[model samples]
Target: MMDIDVPGHIEKVAELEGHDDRAWCVAWNPTKPVLASCSADKTVRLYHFSKTDADTENPSVTFVHNTTISTGHTKTVRSIAWAPSGTTFATGSFDSNIGIWEQESSDEDDEMHGEGVKTGEWECMSLLEGHETECKCVAYSTSGTLLASCSRDKTVWVWEVHPDADFECMGVMMEHSQDVKCVAWHPTEEILASASYDDTIKLYIDDPSEDWFCFTTLTGHTSTVWSLAFSPNGRYLASSSDDCTIRIWERIEQHKWECVKVIEGQHERSIYSLSWGVGKRRGDDGKGEFGGWLASTGGDGKINIYEIYEPPSSSDPKGREPPTHTLIATLPSAHGVHDINHVSWCPRQGYEDLFATAGDDGIVRVWRINLNGQ
Candidate 1:
């Protein structure tokens, strides 16, 4: 394989093992030092990590297996997502059900199960069933008041989260012509986006008097769109496709988005997953004017990281220039020939450089980007 030289080195930190089948997705808790992964093994694994010297430049971190949730799904647990509050999480399964899970409040069972299990028993608080086929992805809105799930049934369902694990179906959106692969919520808005095998993406919003409706459709990908992610600032969106390309879209106007960039020559095979994070670098004001880092991985077993940045004021006086990206690092054969199914950056504020990937090898690997040979 040909190597693409880059500035940073991605070093593997830990290999979390437990899943008996292919691991499909990994998500980091928004408020805690926990990471969650789902698998075809019909289980969810949680890992907790801590920093030894948190205040120093080089901190030693250790990851311990927290617990295993034997989600009572009949098929593969395809996707998992954490609520922004970190108090609850949702799981999507090929059995066509979405499970809402929460930890029991009583600290009675603090004993280890076998080798790694620890603290707080989790329970399936709610089970959502409506999809006619496999549920592909699940995501929570920024405020944790809403949850969105898409399925092979070609429909996107939005649910209103309520107290005591009660959930009400808000709307069922049927805008895709084929299997819906992924669903993502806008960073700071109520808007939702879904990608499909129809090679298109549809955006939806609540119409207040009329309920949720499709407002716009994004078209440009020539093949199945596998995943979708919104930028941290919510001004832009990124998508990966089976065509082996990534497309960047800019919200040019209210209720309108246009494709501004197509990233090619990165992955040679289908791109399964991508994530955007508030990276360590910032622009002039120390705010995140420089956009952030975009990480993608898929069938080729490679992990690619890119820095997305906006042009300086002098270069674009009217500020009309769309953000651009450059590949800063690449790790080939990330799973040693097994396809990497998902990549997610740690959502916590101080751990932007950290990320985890789930692979067909049934292992969840943690990695950190070492910049400037640090």
Candidate 2:
């Protein structure tokens, strides 16, 4: 079900350099070819790339700066998440606040005076301040109803977003023993997953009592779990950790998850972030096959690519074995000795192969994976 002879290449498309301090996270807009990056500089930058400017055969693509918003957060802006509607987004900061930002319908006439500067106004609609310590990450459910945030206080808070953009504290989960690093929502469901410095991943679901509860805890990593991503189909979850391994957890049954695969020893340092996308697999038939593309970025300044093969047939006598993974490409020294903090795949409808990475070097880079003969 996989083309073993197929190979893929990562080509850098754009390099955004405006943050005065380390860039911590990068997230793509769900419905636009735009990206938002947060940094320790207490600011967030947006970049927009034109589709015609993409050159698949070249080594990189060029992106243009759209706008820069200096959020009033006194501390570092750690994470950002865009809503599915693409009209609103949220940022979690070390100031222990979650800022809700919305795009205005039109830009001011003063901002249009510059020749080559594309500018827009983003207003901070509300600031939710309940975390006792640094807020590490924030995520929105696909339906845009629930917003989840994790903090150094060892708790995850879920908020309900009202029609007028007001946020109400729905629940606070205190299941993790150590600082929570990241939170993610299932692609199509209300299921939420949080990774912690205590080396575990916890899954929470909403019960019939109108409360969120932790139903499962996945424990395998020997070090801190930095980030996590759920597969497009929502059947599997991938986690990156300080142990220099990426663990793949498959949902075997309702509320039961198991680690089915572990990628070890490839990354030279702690893996910080991972994302899943779709890419082409070339075959001898001259036609390309499409498969899942997994990318992991780490402190080693490397971005590695792995391919996930098709699932086992239901009629197989062996039943469901662990899915196989193959290393297809490696982009070594991606940030040139600086640690890459986060890498996020573009969630826009037609841009599966595009992704963005934020680094300690104060740079955010965009990349595209190209398969030959595709």
Candidate 3:
């Protein structure tokens, strides 16, 4: 059975329903509560709440940023990402293209010359071309140099986007046996990870000598791995699968990863999404590299969090219960229908405890966890 509980009631802060079709992807600005949701309607909508410094009681409860911008993408937008700098954003679409949008002051004078300040709004700056099929995922490198994208066409395209240059496809990895489902950039390094219907997760690293070839492929999932994440510390990885379980992977050795433990019995359907807490747990011993907490979504339409823990010590050899990783909170109807496709915490964890998920229901849900709740 899918373990689900919605203790926090929801409030309608705001809603934008102009999409012509289902909205499959929504992403929060890495640094702000500002959000962007893309839909099959061939359009992407932008929203920004004014008081970004303040966290809402229930993010879904009100229309904090009633402003909207509809542009970019010609088909269903499958994935959206906020650049690390938070001033620019990127999105991938079934239209087989990726576009970069940035917010800048309208005065064409100081703006283009780098004198004007950022306007905190988004506008289509340029479109990236390379993928041959629907681009399912797009991610920016940690150092903010490259943008990695994957598609149903069975390939991953790495683009070098920096210093305002025309997005150039640096390399392409076409080893997946089936449709590629997800792509993620290493939080701190120049590495990339991808999941595919081929029942495997693969890693790609830049090799100046080998033309940046795919030097590593991770295999272990019985079913398709829908989502993958590199821990904030870059020492661990987490994957959600159709197998209805979340697997924690540790770098047992260089170029090789091992499944350390399994987080099971939380969801009843395929695990559509998974994300490790982004930072160190407060009041923690600070010895280990990652595992502050974890969140996942699946066919059951719920978001569940757990404290990633070590095996019980000798005093409790009988086995202690899993650490509370605490379902500290849950996201309701997280897009509904067990058809949810993705769930991700903002890049910087512990900030408003904000996370977003998108799926078949045509809704991109944003949530905030209140640490000081009654």
Candidate 4:
């Protein structure tokens, strides 16, 4: 066993409330301090942080509800994903439609007074309708040129975002044997990964002759693979599953990937969502903290944080060993027995320590992690 000696703790920053029904997904705007959460109430809510709300010195910040936009989807809005540009977002709904929404000028004259825009400030730009069943998740590529959606129809669809903002169906991958649960894009690459109820994760690559093809399928989970997240460097991927485990995959070659670590017996119930971020590591004299971090939320209503420790050369007498995952902190009932549906880390550079979690309790909670245990 490795002697992991960094103290870690999680502090609740804010509890955002508005949705009348279960909040299914939460996503942070890449270029802004705003956060968007979608719900079973058929509405999407945006949470905004003003200059006062971003007081890093305060240790906790409370964001205000910016707006709530009702999507046209009649069924539950299952997932929300923001584009890299932060100007647009996409929603996957149980109505089997994907809605692309963009920020529009609100008629309310409240903006000049520092008040947020109107509730209906967002407009659906386009609807991509093709799924035969509920669309479970949607994600945009790092460049925002490609969008991927997975469905209960057991199919994954890839779309090309045109210059006019119109989406054209690139190809459909009907490889999963069961309902697709979540889809995620590589942080720095065009590679797309989709998890499914069939206990598999498929990675897709663009092919000029074939449109998009399944480059690889990762297996080993004994139950439904609920979610996936890629490391900031895009070299590693983490997956959570109904089997109550988290699996880590690393890139071995340009087109090859393999599961290198499996974390089991951690959560009491299914692990629903996973998010990766940079964690601070204490120095040799316990002075500093900066390294790889991972957060997982689950059906057990618990949120756990782990430190990804990549040790030094094992052959050297003074060097450390191989990479290992050490649980740093665990918050029980983070959502008060309400299963967390999603957890997303803030994408901004200065706010990487912040994360958001949405749950069946119809609330989204923002958390700040103190890796230094100060």
Candidate 5:
């Protein structure tokens, strides 16, 4: 067993014990270590820990799921994501709908251990309807002004959130014929890329005035493109697939782009998870964190941490290896794990080095990436 960072450094922080179906999706609350998980059981559960007031070093926080929410969907939930603020969350379900959930509790309603009816204090706020078939995934733009939903009906829908008025249906993007499995937004641009079972990744871009538009379709993965992510710099895109490989795409001279590096020979089974780090980059003159690096999980029951090293020199030419990179770690069955579905980095930006992942084995594992190793 290779001692990699992704899984080996993880600890089973919590095990939600009541779901009757497979947990398909998990997301860390953008502002906290708290997390939410969606399941085929048709329910979404919220988990958090309340530290003891007296203990310091031996402080033990129990995994307490304070609430269970089930509404706005007629079938199993497939995907869930927390907004940057963490108070509101979005979920896409097999019922072809996206439901908005909010933290609905007052000081009186907020109990440390939770109150009656809803233990954890979460409620479905609104239901979004439009898709003709099951929705597979959903994401919010960096500004949280737009929400993107992808469905098996071969379309990606964008919705605009209006706090004072009824939510508006922005636009629909149809560029795939098969089920779209994943949708990812560029860190800085208005561009969005989606992976489909059709074996193609389509990049969609929207101007400040236009509702949405398709800029390009990246076709390379031989099998279904299971997952996709844009690098922290927004210049490169990393994707993993059932084809059993990880490929990186970077914008080249002018507007053209090319697959620069193919990180292979790492997985023995299908690659399922790809979580890019979410904190400051390695070297920034002590200015601030830029959120570089990445981690991945796959069907081989393993996880990998890929550090993005700085380029050696401008004269080194494009498409060449960076000055230095270290796999740092290879984790097999992280903490004796098996059947992990996905992995996610905490989205709090400039704050956390932690993340959470869930799988068929019914355990949510929390991992901390230690750069200092101090």
Candidate 6:
């Protein structure tokens, strides 16, 4: 029941309805106008949006139901991730399998929607089966050359993407003693990070011999780590946990990371998801010297947004200061008494302030930051 009319707050702009069961995750297409959401209903829905009045202060965005894939998974589809090419995506399901999806036809065969927006039918191109239990999360590398998946089986798998929709398993990491909750890749590197029920985060890198191995283990959270996100610059990482806190880790040296800051007293329950985006704000020189915005939501049925500022210039000879963050906005009961399972910023450049959240209400809600409160 929080008032969203205040300045510098986040406003709910659209509610997308289709899934008959709880929606678990949402992902934005990196190169298209499409947004994808997966649900416990064992389906994946795609929505396309277009913006009007791009130069105006109050731009309008219209979202249309693009299509829905039956997803063939026997159980709930837990997570989805889009490739950098936007031509393909991957889904991890509770059925203990991963599905690689792609359009059945090329763009020339796509159907046209409002304003000539293109839409296509997608099909599962490959099915990867290895996880012993539910596949909790999936993510593609920045270059789309590798894909990472973690599961309740307590293992992380790395796959090499081939041209004809083929995936070759490169490694299987069993570093976590309990269920792995999420997996994320660094924005500009091949480094892969995974959070787990073991209350730890592990980072992996490809060795010179072409084998992927755990390089470091990060520990600080007192409870299960639920999610992980890297700053836009990839120099820092943020992790949310069942401890109801977020920890920021900075890369201090080559292959070394240290916890520099801990964010607390923001959420009343476990933090399920968080995302970092290149925000609209800039530094004094009118350049993007500062960092981005971080959005988080969880079992408390609330959404919080924080503005992350770059560490100030310091005279310390050893290193610079750690980044600082301020809570900018929050919305309670974002889904009307339903827990939000995921939040993701739109990856497309011009729409950085827009983000989408999936909730236990079986709805995907789109929101925008109103810095001017208009």
For every model shown, the clashing-pair count is 0, 2, 13, 5, 10, 0
Clashes of 4: 5
Question: Residues 1-374, candidate 1, lDDT per residue (tens digit)?
Answer: 67667878788988999999999999998887899999999999999988778889888678999899999999999999999888899999999999999987655445534323236689999999999999999999999999999999999999999998899999999999999999999998999999999999999999889989999999999999999999999988999999999999988778999998899999999999999988877336532258889999999999999988864535443356767787888999999989999999998876889999999999999999888747
lDDT per residue as tens, model 3, 76-124: 7777887787777788888898878877556553454332234455667
Name the better of 4 and 5 by lDDT: 4
Candidate 5 lDDT score relative to the true structure: 0.72
The TM-score that candidate 4 achieves is 0.90
Question: Per-residue CA lDDT of candidate 5, range 1-374, in tens?
Answer: 43344422433444566667767778877666467888888888777744454357434345677667775478988899877766688999999988888765666544554323233456677888898999999998877887889999999987887883246887898889899989988888767889999988888766679767877777788888888888877767888888888888876643455777677788877888787764445555532333365777777787777766545334445655532335655667763546667888767543345667767665566665655442
lDDT of 2 by residue, 1-374 (tens): 23335377788878899999999999888776678999999999988776663455332335788889999999999999998877788999999999999876565545564232334589999999999999999999989999999999999999999976799998999999999999999988899999999999999998977789999999999999999988877878999999999999988887899998899987988999998876544453422233477889989998988877646445352367666687777788889989999998777655677888999999999988777654
lDDT of each: 0.91, 0.86, 0.69, 0.86, 0.72, 0.91
Clashes of 5: 10
Compared with the true structure, the alpha-carbon lDDT of candidate 6 equals 0.91
lDDT of 4 by residue, 132-168 (tens): 9999999999999999999999999999998656999
Candidate 1 residue spans exceeding 4 A from truth: 1-3, 108-118, 282-288, 312-319
Estimated TM-score for each candidate:
0.94, 0.90, 0.81, 0.90, 0.83, 0.94
Give stretches of model 5 more than 4 Å off: 2-16, 50-63, 105-121, 208-211, 253-255, 279-291, 312-325, 335-337, 349-351, 370-373
Please report the TM-score between candidate 5 and the true structure. 0.83
Lowest-lDDT window of 10 residues in candidate 1? 109-118
Error of 2 at 354 (Å): 1.4
Error of 2 at 130 (Å): 0.7
